[model samples]
Target: MSKFDSLYIAAKEKLLAAKNIAMVTHINPDGDCTGAALAVRKLLLALGKDADIYNEQGFPSFMEFLRGDAVFNRYTQEDGVEYDLTVFIDCGNIDRAGKVAWVCEKSDFIINIDHHSTNPMFGDINIVDSTASASGLLIYDFFKACGVEITLEVANFLYVAIMMDTGNFSYSNTDKRTHDVAGDLLELGVDPSVLTQKILRSTTYNKLKLTAMAIDTLHMYCDGKIAVIHASKAMYNATGTDSSDSEGFVGMIRDIKDVGFAVFLRDTTDGKLVKVSIRSNLDVDVSKIAAEYNGGGHYSAAGCSIEGKIPDVEEIIVKRLSEEL
Candidate 1:
C-alpha cells in the first residue's frame, strides 16, 4: 500500500472517533478546496458525525450552485464553542487556512487532507498526494474506502472540483487516473453538460465586457512567446465587475498561438495587493515563480498575491519569466 493509504487509514479512525468536527480550506478558496471540504462534510454527516465547514472569505458566485449554504460558515472566533476535531482540506499550510488556523490550533485533533506538493504537514494526521489532480479525488477515495454513499450533490460538487483544477481535463495534470476518477464521478450521475454550461457559458454581460477590456491590454513579450495582462482597481471599478469576474481571463492570453506562458495581474479589494495567476504551455514551471512570493501550486498553473501596484508586479513577473523564453 502507498504511504498515503496508511495515513488515510489512520486519519479515518481518528475522524470516526471524533463527534464534533470542523472543516476548513485555504483562503480565497477555489473549486478543489471547496469541493474537498463539502465532500468530507457530506461523508461525515453520512457517518452520523456533526461536521461544520468554515472559510473566511466567501466563494465566487459560480460556486453558489454547489451545496454551500447550510454547511459553509464564515469564521468568527467564539468564546465557548470549540470543535472536538478540525479537518483542513486542500490547504498547503496552516497559514493558508487563514483565521481557521487558530481554530485548528485549539481543536483536540487535527487532520490535513490535500494534493499539493508543498503541504506543510501541519496536522496530527496528513493525507497528501502530490500526483493527484485535485483533493476532491482523494476525498472520493476516502468515501469509497469508508463505504459512504455518493449522492448526486456530492458527485456534482466533486466533479466541479476535479474539472476546474484539471482545466476541463486539458491541463498537464490530467493523467489516466484523473480520467478514471472523473469517469467514476460521472457514473454517480454528474451532469457534465449542465455543469459546463453553468460554469463556462453562463457569464454576465458585465463580465464579458470586462474580459474584453482585459484582453485588449494583453501584451506580447519574448517574440510572441509570452502574453501578459494587468487589471487595476480602476479598471475593475470602471467595468463594474468584481475581482471574481476576472477569473479565466488569463486563459485568453494562453490560447494565443505560439505563446508558451501567460500572466494576469489584478488588484485585489484592498487595492494595495495585486493577485497574479500564471499559466504555461511548455517546459516552464510557473509554480516556482509563484513560490518566490511565498505561494504554492501546480507546475503549469499557479498563483501568488503581491503587495504592489499592478504595473510593478507585472514588470517583476515579466522580467523573471523572460529568462525562460
Candidate 2:
C-alpha cells in the first residue's frame, strides 16, 4: 500500500458520512485547484450526494469550459449556506481559502487535499503528498478508492489540472508515473491538441498587449542569472487588462536563456499589495523565497505577495534571488 493510503481511507470515511459537502480551493484558483475541486464534486454527485464548489475568486476564463461551471460559486453568490463536510484542495493552508475559510468553520469535518511540501496540514484529515504532481492526481486516486469509473468529464478536468501544473509535461515534476497517469487520461479520450489550443494558444488581444508591456519591463541582474518583470497598475489600465490577463507572464521571463531564476511582480487589484511569482530554471529553490513572504509552492515555481509598490517588491525579491544565486 502507498504511504497516503491510510489518509485516503480516513478521508473516505469522513466523505462517506457527509451528505452535503462544500468544496474550496486556494485564492487565485489554478487549473490543478479548479480541476481537483470539480472532479471531487463529480465524484460526490455520482454517489448521489450534493456538492457545492466555492472559491473566493472564481476560476480563469480558460477554465469555464470545465464541467460544473453552474454550480461553482463565489462566497457572495451563495445565500448563507452550510455543509456537513468542507474539503479544501490544492491549498497549502486553511487561510489559503481566503474569506471563505470562515464559512468552512461551520462544517462538522474538514479535509485538506494538496501536493505542496509547505502544506500546513490544517484539517481534520489531511491528504498531502508533496511528491504528487498535482492535487487533481490525488483526486484521481480518490475516484479509484471509491470504485468510480473515470468519466470523460472527470478525465478532461484532471487532464487540465495535470497538464497546466506540469507545464504540459515539460516541467521537472513530470515523472514516469506522471506520464503513466497521462496515458490513462489519454485512454479516456482527452485530446492534447485541442486542450493546448484552448488553453495556451487562445490568448486574448488585450492579454497579448499586456504581455508586450510586461516584456518591455524585464530586468536582468546577477550577471543575467536572475531576471525580473514588473507590471504596474497603469500598464494594466492602459492595456485594458486585469490580473487574469497577466497569467503565465512569468514564464516568458523564465525562458530567458542563462537565467537561473525569474521573478514577476504585478500590482494587486486593490493596489495595497504586489503579487510576486517566481520561476527557477535550476540551482535555486524559488519556493523557499516565496515562503519568506508568506507564499509557498514547488521548488521551481512558487508565488507570494508583499505589501508595497510593485517596484519595492521587485527590488526586495531581486535582491534575495541575487543572494541565493
Candidate 3:
C-alpha cells in the first residue's frame, strides 16, 4: 500500500461527488501539468462525469503530438460560470494558475495535485508527494486506487508527463519506480523514439536561432561553479522568437563541464518582466533560491518571474544564487 493511498481516497471522494469538473493547469503549461490535466479529463469521462480543462496560456506547439486532434479548452478570464470542483494539476501554488485563479474562488471544491517540493498544500484535498518525480505518477497512482485501467491514451500523456519532468529519464529524479511505470507504458506500445523525435528533435530554425543568441550571453560566476545565460528582448526580436522559444536553454548551461548550477533569465517580449529559470547538477537546491522570488519547483529545476528590467533582475538573481554557492 502506498503512503498516498488515503489522500487518493479522499481525492476520489471529492471527484466522485462533483458533477461538473474544471481542470486547471499552471502558467506556461508543460508536459507534466498538461499530461496530468488530460488524464484527469479522461478519468472523469471514464467515470461518466463532465470535465473541461482550462489552461490560460494554452498548449505548447511542441507538445501537439500529445493532444493529437483534440483541442484544449482555453480559460479566457471569464467568471460567469461556476464549477462543482476545480482540480489544479502540477501547480505548486494557487498563484501559479495565473489568470484562471478566479476559478478557485468560484469552485465549490479544490483539489491540488503536484510533486513540487515547495507545494504549500493549497487544495481542500492536496495530493502532493514532493518525492515523486512527476505529478503524472500521482495521477497514475490515483487511477490504481480507483481500479481504473491504464489505457493507452492515458499512458501516452502520462509517459510524456514523466519523461518531460524527468528529462527523459536521464535526470536525477528518475528512480526504480519511475522506470517501472515507464516500462508499463512501453508495454502499452508507447513508441519512445517516435515521441522523442516529435519533442526534442523537431525544433524550428527560429528556435535554434534563439538558442544561438541565448548562448552568446553565457557567463560563469562563483569561480565557474555557477553558469548563467539570458535571452534579452532584443535577442528575441532579432531571432523572431518569444520566451517560449527559450525552453531547454538552462539545461544546456547545467550540462556545462564542472558547472554545478545554471540560471537563465528571459526578458519577456514586453520587456517589463523577466522570467528566471534555474537548474542544478550538484548539491545546491535551486528551488530554494527560486522560492525567495516566489517561484516554486523541484530541486533540480525551478523558476520565478520578476517584474523589472532584465539587467536588474539578472543582478538580483545572480547575487542570491551566489550566496547559495
Candidate 4:
C-alpha cells in the first residue's frame, strides 16, 4: 500500500460525507497547484458532488484555458466563502494559500494533498508524500483507489500538473511511477506534444522580452558552477510583464554549460522585496538554502522571499550558493 493509502480512504470518506466542499489552490498558482485542484474538482463532480476552486489569483495566464468561463466555479479568497470541507492541493503550508488560509478556520475539515517535502502536515486528513513527483500523482492514485473513471479533462489536468512540476519529466524527481501515472493519463487521451506546444512553446512576446532583459543581468560565480539571473521592477515595466512571465527563468539558466546551480531573483510588484527561485542540476539540495531564508521546497528546486534590494539579495544568495557549492 502507498504511504497515503489510509489518508486517501479517510479523505474519500470525508469527501463523500461533506456537502459543501471547496477546493483551494495555493498563492501564485502554478500548473501543478492549479491542475491538481481543478482535477480534484472534476473528480468530486464525477463522484456526484460539485466543488468550487479558489485561489489568491484565479489562474496563471498560461493556463487560462483551464479557467475558461469558470465564473461561479473559480473564486478568490476575498469571496469569504465557508465550507464543511476545504481541500488544499499542492500547498506546502497554509500560509502558501495566502489570504485563503483563513478558510481553514471556517472549514470543519481540511484535507491537505501535496508532494512537497517541507509540508507541515496541516490537514485533518493529510495525503502527502514527498516521494511523489507531483501532487497530480497522488490525486491520480486517489482516483484509481476509488475506482473512479479518469476522464479526458481529468487526464489532461493531471498531465499539465505532472509534466510541469517534473520539468517535462526531465527533472530528478521523475521515476518509474511518475511515468506509470503519465502512461495512464495518455490512455485517457492526454496529448503530450499538444500540451508541450501550448504550455512550453507558447511563450508570450512580453515574457521572452523580459527574459532577454533578465539574461543581460546574468552573473557567474564559483568557476561558473553557480549562475545568477535577475529581473528587476524596471525590467518588468520595460517589458510590460510581471513575475509570472518569468516563471522558468532559473531552470532556463540552469541548462547553461558548467552551471550546476542557477538562481533567479525578481523584485516583487510592491515593497523592497525580492522573490528568489533556485534550481540545481547537481547533488546539492537547494531547498536547504531557501530554508535559511524561511522558505522551502524540494532537493533540486526551491524558493524564498527576502526583504532587501534586488542587488543586495542577489549578492547574499550568490555568496550562500558559493558556500554550498
Each prediction's TM-score against the native? 0.93, 0.95, 0.95, 0.94
**For residues 1-325, what per-residue lDDT tens digits would candidate 4 score against the true structure?**
4767777888888999998988787777888988887788777877898776677766787887766445323333445567899998998888787766777787899999998898889998888899999999998988877778888988998999999999999988999999999998999899999999999989878888998898999999889998999998888998998778888888879999989889999886554988899998888887788888988889999998899998789889888888876
Question: Would you list the rank order by TM-score, best first?
Answer: 3, 2, 4, 1
**lDDT, candidate 1, at 33:** 88
User: Which digits, one per residue and each the tens of the lDDT, describe model 3 over residues 80-189?
Assistant: 78888999999989989888788888799898989999999988888889989999898989888888888998998899899998999999999998998889889988
| Cα lDDT of model 2 by residue, 97-189, tens digit | 887777577788889899988887888888889898988789888888777889988999999999989988998999887888889999999
Candidate 1's residue-wise lDDT over 94-198, tens digit each? 877777677786699888888877677878888888899989889888877777889989998889889888888987789998899889888989989999888
Cα deviation at 206, candidate 3, in Å, is 0.7
**Candidate 2: residue 98 lDDT (0-100):** 81
Worst 10 residues of 3 by lDDT: 68-77
Alpha-carbon local distance difference test for all models: 0.82, 0.84, 0.85, 0.85
Model 1, TM vs. native: 0.93
Candidate that scores best on TM-score: 3
Local lDDT at 142 for model 4: 85
Considering only N, C-alpha and C atoms within 3 Å, which residue pairs clash in candidate 4? Answer: none
Candidate 4 structure lDDT: 0.85
